[model samples]
Target: MLGNLIRYLDSVVARDPAPRSRWEVLLYPGVWALFWHRIAHRLFNARLFFLARAVNHLSRFLTAIDIHPGATIGKNFFIDHGFTVIGETAHIGDNVTIYQCVTLGGSNPTNGVGGKRHPTLEDNVIVGSGAQIIGPVTVGKRARIGASAVVTEDVPEGATMIGVKARSTLVKAETYAKEFMPYGTPCKEPCEPVGSQRVDELEEQVAVLREQVAALVEANEQLARKAEKPGKPACKGV
Candidate 1:
């Protein structure tokens, strides 16, 4: 219990330090997620609705975690940084690691009021940051939801969801891990560079565009300030 409290404090502190080392923050989020979840579950089961809501709101405010009071999360559920959110009816299985900005929500017309308006995630699943798993679908055990994906349908066991609308990029776990994910990268898929030169060229172009945009913005601001200033008295020819 004391350990959980310490972890929770660590997680809360992690968010405030943007410049802190990534490795330091990485460990706390997972630990704190499970800790808060235990408290939230207890409050929910005890029918302490107000207390549960308050705790939920406070956790989200402090950790960028937006878990609903009614969400049923299993043991060892790890919610990583980057803004993690779970809907009211989302059912999470054991040992699931969900990264930031991943929304496990439902789109049913009867949602927000009640009636099973969220997805069920099976055990050992890992959802990357910015992934959206919507509706009453089920993600099978050990499945992986890639970054920025939009999943609306059921995902089979040990499958991987990627791309818009979230198709099964790979169904087999071993192959999927080898192809999509990398080692020690915190649920990130190995980016398949189009080509070394191509990537470098695109990066260079982006840098140039950013510079131009910055210059234009600065110039515009200067012009606005000058326009707001009282008209300079007719400049002396001298």
Candidate 2:
């Protein structure tokens, strides 16, 4: 238990720049929430459902972070701010970091009583503020969810998800892990200019238009040649 506490503190300190000392980290709301959650999870695994729920309720009241006791969480998990929600069927992997207002929830809340409904975040995942990962999708390892992104489908490993209905952009996780962005925004790469794909699409359209124009010019020339030929005269208005 002491070892786990030390590891948790170490992880928080390593990831966050604000918490300077272990004492300060111990007082952090996120740390306290995780501490109680560990106890609640143990009771839940032991089939003491009522006690687990009670413990989780208390933790939520204190920390403002609602994590269902039935959810499975791996080590080195860090929540940057409060008001985060983890559903009962949600599974979080190791080295995961989540910011404020993040929700790992179900798409169909009323249905799937016995089945998995929430998302499963794999190792080294980072969820930005107000990001919602819904349904039974598995966000792959080392993936980063950008702020306010709504993810409904599975995210590939080492991918960065951004925007509503989340578009994925690939980035090497090893390089990303070296520096942490406050809102899970990755450093811009040279190859990825903003709206570059749209520009390429527009260029393709222009090329097609040019080709059509050239074809029309050739056809007009052929008609003019036929009209100028001997015994073939241009038609007069009727």
Candidate 3:
């Protein structure tokens, strides 16, 4: 148990630069939240539903992170900061990292039966702050979800998702693909909103039109100046 705890703390230290030592990592709210969740999950599996809920509530009150007791979490899972919500059916794989304000949310069941409503995150997946992975979608291994992304569909392995209703963007640098990237996205990735190309095209057209209008105005002013001069007269049919 001590060895496992040390490894878990080491994993967090590797991912987060804020902690100076393993003891400081112990003070993190996420570690405490996970500790409570381990006990709560065991109680839930034993059919001690009320007790599991009580522990979940206590953990949430202490850590500001709401993880359902029924959620399954694997080894070295790290939640950076707090305000993260993991639904009852959510399954998190080993070494998965979730940033603050991220939600592993569920969809409303039409038949009123609750079964696998939440998302499953594969191993080494990183979710950025405020990212929402809704429904029973599977985020494949090593996929990176960008900040404020809304993902409702399964994400392909090695993909980088960004923007509202997240879409995969081209991964730059094959060598850096497997490296641990902070915030689940590379700082240089050109992640943009849907239809960003069209928006760019429209902006270019508007700029061209403005330049043409400016030139027309300058020509009109030049003609007016020439007409106003005593030496110049308006041309008429000879």
- Tens digit per residue, CA lDDT, model 1, 31-130: 5555566688689889998888888777776676778878888755666564777888889987677777888877867434558778999987888889
- Cα displacement (angstroms), candidate 3, residue 84, comes to 0.5
Give me the overall lDDT of model 1: 0.73
- Worst 10-residue lDDT window, candidate 3: 186-195
> For model 3, how does the per-residue alpha-carbon lDDT over 172-219 read when each residue is reduced to its tens digit?
323466678554443232335424776999999999999999999999
Q: After superposition, how far is residue 153 of candidate 2 from its true place, in Å?
A: 0.3
Ten-residue segment with the worst summed lDDT in candidate 1? 181-190
* Residue lDDT tens for model 2, 209-237: 99999999999999999998789447867
Candidate 1, position 147, lDDT: 92
Residue 208, model 2: lDDT of 100
By TM-score, the candidates rank as: 3, 2, 1
Off by over 4 Å in 3: 172-175, 183-238
